[model samples]
Target: MSGRRSPGDGGLYWDEKRGRWIASLTVGYTAGGRRIVKKASGKSKTEAKNKLKEIIRDYEDGLALTSSNETVAEAVRYWLEHGLKGRGDSTVILYTGFANNHVIPAIGARKLKDLSVEDIDRWLAGKARQLSTRSLKIIYSILNRSMRNAIVRDKVKRNIVALCEIPDGCEGRVSKALNLNQAETVLSSAEQADARIGGYIILSLMTGARTEELRKLSWSHVVAFDAEREVWLPVTETGWNHTDYAVYVWRSVRQGGDTKTAKSRRTLKLPQHAVEALRRLWEHEGLDKTDDCAGLGERLVFTTKNGTALSAGNVRRDFRKVIAKAGLTAAEWTPKELRTASCPCCRTPVSPSSRSHAWSATAIRRSPRPSTASRSTP
Candidate 1:
């Protein structure tokens, strides 16, 4: 019986002692022994043959006998908590929000092995229905990153979400800025006011500086340049609000901090009008008696009555008030809109040069026969 090979049964035979047709396979060495494995049930011969064939094929393919069986939610959590542990706090918040609000609810229970490209597309479409395309894109990026981590661990074979596209209507909607007349009216209204809010409004409109950059402007980065000399800082140590005029470098806010992009970091010369507004703000704050006047290099350009940093929310609220007080429509006015919409003759975006009131140069140069320098707005 031991020497005889069974016909058409592969390695399967009837074990008389066990009273069953035992489907035996020769597995590789285990503990210095050639382990022969057998599986049997009181089933038909065909069923036995099929089951044995599957097990043998799987073994030959170098597949594990058991799976990690990591669920999507569980795997994503592990990936986030361990793999992305070193990411910034803001990034972590964004990823966590996307997972909690979008990914987990859709297909979180499925094992990582079971995720498919179709599953990702369906999930992305459903997310697009709820969130803006930009928000949906963020969620997709996080989930895709998580799945890629799973691939690295051999938990999944591919990243399905990478094949998906951001759905329609999920794009960045560009809000138009105010025209030149409206910008003039808004700036004029802010100028007549007795508070730093007016100056903040003017700065935003003139330089296209983001709200926080203006509010958090310090004296250290204030470069004083005249047409006579290239840019340089004055020796006098005065608070930014007290300085007559100064150049604002977008980078001076915080090196390697949150900003839109590298191109967003700009240097714009503040006009005399804006400089006067800053001086008045300085006198109003009574900084003459404070250490900040000596150019301590740390004072909020726009602050509350008590000299605390001005919140963007509060600035927007006050900006609307100033607009209304000036008999302007709040609907048509936003600080960002005011900055970018002022110059159509040049047909260029709001730039540091445009902010410096160099409209004529920018306008005349755009005669269709462009200079190489004219094409580069940076």
Candidate 2:
């Protein structure tokens, strides 16, 4: 026989061995005979009874458990593989990165039913102690969403992870950006390292172009009006530029997205120093490719020694070493930090213009705003 039914929800079941009341919600009408059962963890019957009531109410109202059969690991894989479809490539990559790096290692094997709110809270706390709060927040969100999917499908009684609190005061304040002296050191360092990297770094700092934008930059994107060049005057053309030569931000390559905002896609002008560096790079890489210029017009400015588009991972590793050798605190200074530290507003500004038909309209900005008060970690 069933225990008592509270108000509008399904009846409860009393487990003889466990000596507790479990929430049993059966849905699918008539001959279907499908049973959806949820349990509340408490020693006393009354305590479990009340919690069980809530689960039945939610279930009856159509919040059934969907992700019950799979382990947390299986659910996460499905979530990334299918749930995140139609999202940007970068989004998929980031989710995959976090699941593999943090979630799978910590709680992947645990059954969804075995995971408790307290267990999740403890995991998040540990992550907070080690990683940036931003990362933890992302993890929290992924778990919350993944479990929420389970709930709607009648797998779990509720999204237990939604109850977990995000760590407070864990994010470091924004402290990136280089002053003039530091900018010169970095630029000179890049110059001494390799003319190619030197020009790329200087252009990045000056134009505020994204690393990938520079990576995918082709000679076609840069239009020096022959008339303007002959006159030694600022060409009224714009591709992309920044107010700070040290801090450049353009588009995200991983996602193939444009600037994060309409304001971000505006054109920028380089300082005299940055232009000079670019001129040298153009002559070297440009000329080298011209003779064998098999793909001279492939449309990327920064390339590998073999003239293919640059990779972000390779650039970070190689550039960090170069920056360190150049006398910058390589550990604290990153390519991104260079852009943030330098004030591009100090450079010659460029005006924004629409790309012609020859240029593919692939410009779309990624969101610059980080997830601030989310329930998950990344």
Candidate 3:
């Protein structure tokens, strides 16, 4: 009597008042124990069934009609609160800042289901004025990943953000390094005044060690060669000057105090200039030799006069002074750039004992490609 139809086939019947065929399906039940029904209307019964099929396709693709009221801000907030499980605190702070400052403020009012390619495009275009291209890309990644998380949880049917292309953003600061001539001036200038910074520049330029790696160097890692025994002994054991020397580069100031990469941990034979500079520092500090390595090795090779660890600010301020002393523009250069300086095989060549380490074996001969690539801008 009633137009109930088969269970999956959906009910089709003529609506006399509207003069149209109406199709309705009792697909399932809602979480609150209410029936979930879908309905469509068309002039013909066939058209009504086809319209019903379209709704089924959308449901199959994970699109939920009830989620239409969920806003983009809600989705972004959900991700910020509960999504980042293993991510670092700094990452959480950074992503939260980006979302709140840049992303959410612009498009957060829109419904998640209604977000479109044009919305994202216009948002990214506006950001181009304020952020660098790299920063824009990062925010774009954050948005795209958030949308992907929403899709997996059935908050949305698909990630339209994935379809959006990143637009070019504002320019960024340029990175550069000293050339060979400038390297000579900095070396000569530092050696005349401060052994700490002198050894820093020589070792950084000669070995290409990162600034963080150098700062974390301890006395125990510095080893002096034993001519008779043919071995490398800690500066803690043998004191500062032996014929040849090397440093065990196993430490850094990275998260958990590990090197940036597995291969970054290495042994580097000191260049003659670096050795002399470190020797001067050892004597200047008047550090005493000790038989117990546990105590002696823990002593940092470089630190503030207060014996605390050096901060980036401390290094940068001192390094700029060194730059000014070298007759170079202090405002234009940085300590990290020393590693990227061209022709590392400056006048104070690596000691003939370079063969002791694998990287140092060819270190004296193979200079990294000219560092002029980054300076192409300014």
Best by TM-score: 3
Clashing pairs in 1: 133-170, 177-337, 178-337
Model 1 segments beyond 4 Å from truth?
1-66, 188-196, 223-231, 234-244, 250-255, 258-266, 303-335, 343-378
lDDT of 3 by residue, 239-297 (tens): 65577777767788765677777777766776677777888887777775434644667
Of candidate 1, the 10-residue stretch with the lowest lDDT total is 359-368
Clashing residue pair totals per candidate (backbone < 3 A): 3, 46, 0
RMSD of each: 8.3, 10.6, 8.7
Give a tens-digit lDDT track for model 1, residues 50-157: 767765676677643324578889877877798776676657877888888788888899887778878888877777767886787777777888888877776765
* Deviation from truth (RMSD, Å), model 3: 8.7
C-alpha positional error of residue 55 in candidate 1 after TM-score superposition, expressed in Å: 7.8
Error of 3 at 21 (Å): 20
The TM-score ranking, best first, is 3, 2, 1
Q: Give the runs in model 3 whose Cα sits over 4 Å from its true position.
A: 1-57, 64-74, 77-83, 88-101, 170-175, 192-198, 254-263, 280-286, 289-293, 298-300, 303-314, 343-378
Cα lDDT over the full model 1: 0.61
Compute each candidate's TM-score over C-alphas: 0.65, 0.67, 0.69
- Compared with the true structure, all predictions reach lDDT values of 0.61, 0.60, 0.75
